[model samples]
Target: MKKVAFIFPGQGSQKIGMGKDFFENSDIAKDMISKASERLGINFEKLLFEENDKIGQTEYTQPAILLVSSIANAIFKETSNIKPEFVLGHSLGEFSALVSAGAIDYLDALELVHKRGKFMNDACAGSGAGMMALVGLDDEKVETLCKEQREKGLKVWPANYNMDGQLVLAGLKADLESLIDTFKEAGAKRAIVLDMSVASHCELLQSAVENLRPYLEEFLIDSFEVDVISNVTAKAYNTKEEAIDLLSEQLINPVKYKHSIASKDEDVDAFIEFGNGIVLKGLNRKITKKPTLNVSDMTSLKKTIEALNE
Candidate 1:
């Protein structure tokens, strides 16, 4: 039997019609998505199944993505007896991971991420802030650039350490533009600006972290049912309090995903992305060279279950 590790993707992985396949085919998925729609008070299915600009807006986007990802997981669980030995999510996907571990109720997670999206969006309002992916730079160089820029009073920092030579930087829009040419000169293969205006996972969201802390505290999180890794520390979460702390800090700290993937690579036989896109599967291939598959929709889910049954 394969030792599977289910990894969930974060924002940027969400897209129109992401969960429609599973929702249409499985009563299990339909029920969960329907309940989320009622609890969140929005036609989340329409928001996800149809093309709309609101799907891109942070407040609406967060909750919508969570609903789909959670339902996808539920379908996979109901149909197959093969369970993941470990689970982890990237950035916003951590909330989904918490749900998979039975640490947080799915309804609470839906509400939490919706509020989190609002907090982050409000923080970025009029700040002229955003993020960029700088490929071909190592951690030391990226950290040095951030430190030097901060010394010069620029609001820039490494927001995500996805893998070696791939760092996502976030900060004031002006500061990001200033580094483009310099990064190109430093032999970066790409210094692409992300479409998002929100400077997520950086100090710019420090206030958002503080504001979201109390909301997290109100959750009745149980002890984790399965090991779920943390994005901020790139380590396994040991306690409910620790998971909650990191979720808040995740808004303001760099995502240590390279280390997280590396930490688990030797333990699992296969890596599977359970949500919207192939983003996590791609990352696992780039970082760990592991066998990875994505079950984003119904077809992929059937294929994966067959492979597991074999």
Candidate 2:
């Protein structure tokens, strides 16, 4: 049997009109959007389709992206025979993965992500914290560079180990600036700052993690039917307790994505990036030379279905 995995993208992958295709064509998509609007008490549809880039703030973007991703996953389940053997998500996308795997209900996931976005936004307010991507550098070299910078009063650290030559760093604005020259001096191809407001996956998010603890404790999570990989530890989480704990700790812990992707079982025949963009597909290519598909729209979904059947 050929195994398939569903991968979900995180915050930076969100764009206006992400799920608009599915919303117009699929009843499930419409219902999911409507429910998200009612639960969050905000016009999620309007934010997704009408707001353009203005609503890309943390509070709105997190839930909006997750909602779009979940709808996409639902569409696949309803329309195709392609069942996922394993599911994984990047950063905030992990919530979507859990929902798709039947570990958490859609409403609970929506509310949790909404609250999580608010917590993250609150923690980052007035901190001058941000993220930057460093290209063409190995993980060890980047870690060493960040440590050296930290010794010089820079708070920078490896935040996302995205792929072989790509890593995201998070810390105070000044700290990032301080490392720019060093990054270039170390032969980095590019060291560009991302527009993210928070220094996520770093100690700066400890306050947000603390705020999220209560919600995790209160939510009723059950064991997942499908294997869901954890971003915090880069391993499969089987029990409800482990899932809840990983969800809470993910806020402040660095994403072990490299290990997670590298550890995927050899039985995986193809990888499908379930929503938004080709980010995960790109990362998958770095880890293994496998065929990867990206399904963010109806056309892509049809193509993927045909390809899988072939």
Candidate 3:
């Protein structure tokens, strides 16, 4: 069998009714959601199914997305016999990756990200931080431009190494608010300021990194059930010791997803995003010409299984 890598998405992928079908149809999935609600003292079904702003808030969004993605991963395991050769997650999705690898306990991963979200939200409460996607500029140009702009007091940094020409920049809201024209003037096709209030995977979340250290120290994580890639380093997290500091530093460092994917491209034959939305599949299309799938629901799952089986 050719190796397959499973990539789990981060915070932005969450939506209402993401895993409602799994919760309704599978005992294991139902028990998982129920446990999450009981443990977090929040009604996941209500928060995830209803039309509310709570799902948009970081504190609620983190745990909710984690539960749904993990449950989806669990359902994927139950419904199919295929096993992924490598696993990775982007930013908040790293917890889901760790859970898939068995490096972090599922419930512990859930609670940790919950607190992690609160810490990040608390850290950014008054900073007026923000992020934007700068498309059509290569990594070097974007990095150089961001560095130059930062010195001029805009303080922008490339936050996500998404692909060849797509970079997500994070910095102060006022600084990013003005970069639209400047980037377009500098040759960017589009400078889309994201709706996110928190500047994730950047120095803005340094306080969250500090606040999350203790939880990492306390958690009794097991060795990997499957090899997992790191977000900050874009390398394999071969041991639990490496995972702890990297997980904490993820809040403060840029997400090097392009490098991580490149590291596995030669080794893996298929790339599957096993969570909400087809974000990673689109990203994979940008990163490589691999056969990719997004298995968030029944349709995508069936398609992925059929392709992989064939």
As for TM-score, the candidate ahead, 1 or 2, is: 1
Q: What is the clash count for each candidate, in the order shown?
A: 0, 0, 0
Ordered list by lDDT, greatest first: 1, 3, 2
Deviation from truth (RMSD, Å), model 3: 1.3
Candidate 1 off by > 4 Å: none
Query: Which residue pairs clash in candidate 2?
Result: none
lDDT accuracy of residue 121 in candidate 3 = 90
Residue 77 of model 1 has an lDDT of 85
Please list the Cα RMSD from the true structure of every candidate, rounded to 1 decimal place: 1.2, 1.4, 1.3
Give the range of the ten consecutive residues with the poorest summed lDDT in model 3.
Answer: 217-226
* Clashes by residue pair, model 1: none
TM-score of each: 0.97, 0.96, 0.96
In candidate 1, what residue range of length 10 has the lowest lDDT sum?
A: 219-228
> Model 3 compared with the native: what TM-score?
0.96
lDDT per residue for candidate 2 within 1-310, as digits (tens), equals: 4578888899889888789999999999899999889988989888988856646888888888888889888889888867887899999889889888898888888888888988987888899999999998898999998888778877898999888888999999778977788898898999998877788888888888888888876654776788899998888886788887888888877888777878885758888888887888878887877788878989999998888888
Name the lDDT of candidate 2: 0.85
